[model samples]
Target: MPGYKNPDLEYLDQQGNVVGYGEVKTVGDADQSAFNKQLAKAVKQLRVREDVEGKMDVNEIFIQVPDLVDAREVRGWFRSYQKGRLHHGSDLEKISGYHVRVYTGSGSKLADVDLGVDADGGHYDESTHTYYSSNGYSY
Candidate 1:
């Protein structure tokens, strides 16, 4: 919204008289680029939160360190992806904690699952093999 100002603050000349006419400008290329960058960052953060939350919602399943891989690492180096749709930060700034449960396989237990990473950039627990809850809030 455009702000309301005293008439003097608007079109006043050196003599404090209205010029009667002036130009109203639109956002320029630079402004658009800045907006885009900020938008991307926001999206990245949202995606990161969703991804972390999804994994944490999985039932309790404890696996060894050698079992699964960090999906983020496999994906790419993202300070935040797609502008911030996914924030690949040290901290998982989305989920509170995890609800883990194990499901046994018939013969082979493939360790190609999600290993939740906390905001501090640490694995939840190597032995428990479950995603950890945040400190009551996402950072």
Candidate 2:
């Protein structure tokens, strides 16, 4: 018609080919509730597929720890002197014993030593010098 002032909706196929007639887009007589319900269902399905079951766990992930380390030891013999340079034992044995290394912020490295949690579990260095012990830790 000659005095048409409305836009048309051009339908396209899967291959982007125009195959059908055009229809005008309007808010007239639209089932908005049904459209919203379908949209919510699609979103729910996508969320379910990307759930925690589809994600990898910590045990399934792989990480590498260097056996031979060259960092500054904060406890035993080697200690840190400079700022931003802090290190503890790389080997499991050094941190296994009762006498563990402690760093004091009073300009003293290995200024204090504390006992571990028995012969099995170990002590935890809460702060630089503050130490706590636990016997339930695996390593």
Candidate 3:
């Protein structure tokens, strides 16, 4: 726990269980370095929560960016980047067991784009700007 990083945002449910963790980055253009750094930090935080603390209840991990392109680039980097187990790439992939979400928005506004699955195993519907899971639940 001494060396573990902390995510920008940690969402918890009513029961105080960690439901998700998020990292927010507002940057100019698609800067891979900044994106990777923030993402890596979030992933490491999640790793400590999951692997070290045994918090298996966390359901999702997300990265929020002001630019959609940056979000896409971050997603791409997560999919392709390679690193050791305790490093960025692998830590990110590990947290993705609960699925990774990349939402584009700032402040407290509803996200313009939600790029991941919802709680019920369904993908976000871009057209409706809504999340519809396989169990017919919409969020």
CA lDDT of each candidate?
0.29, 0.26, 0.49
- What TM-score does candidate 3 reach? 0.49
- Sort by lDDT, top down from the best: 3, 1, 2
Q: Candidate 2 on 83-120: residue-level lDDT in tens?
A: 11123223323222212222222323332222222322
Question: Which parts of model 1 have CA positions greater than 4 angstroms off?
Answer: 1-30, 55-139
lDDT of 3 at 101: 53
Sequence-dependent TM-score of model 1: 0.19
lDDT of 3 by residue, 1-139 (tens): 5646675677889998776665555534455566556655655666676666565554444555554453234434543433333353334334445544555555322222222222325565577656544644343
Error of 1 at 51 (Å): 0.7
Off by over 4 Å in 2: 1-29, 52-139
**Between the candidate structures 1 and 3, which one is better when assessed by TM-score?**
3
Q: What's the TM-score of each model vs. the native?
A: 0.19, 0.18, 0.49
Better of 1 and 3 by lDDT: 3
lDDT of 3: 0.49
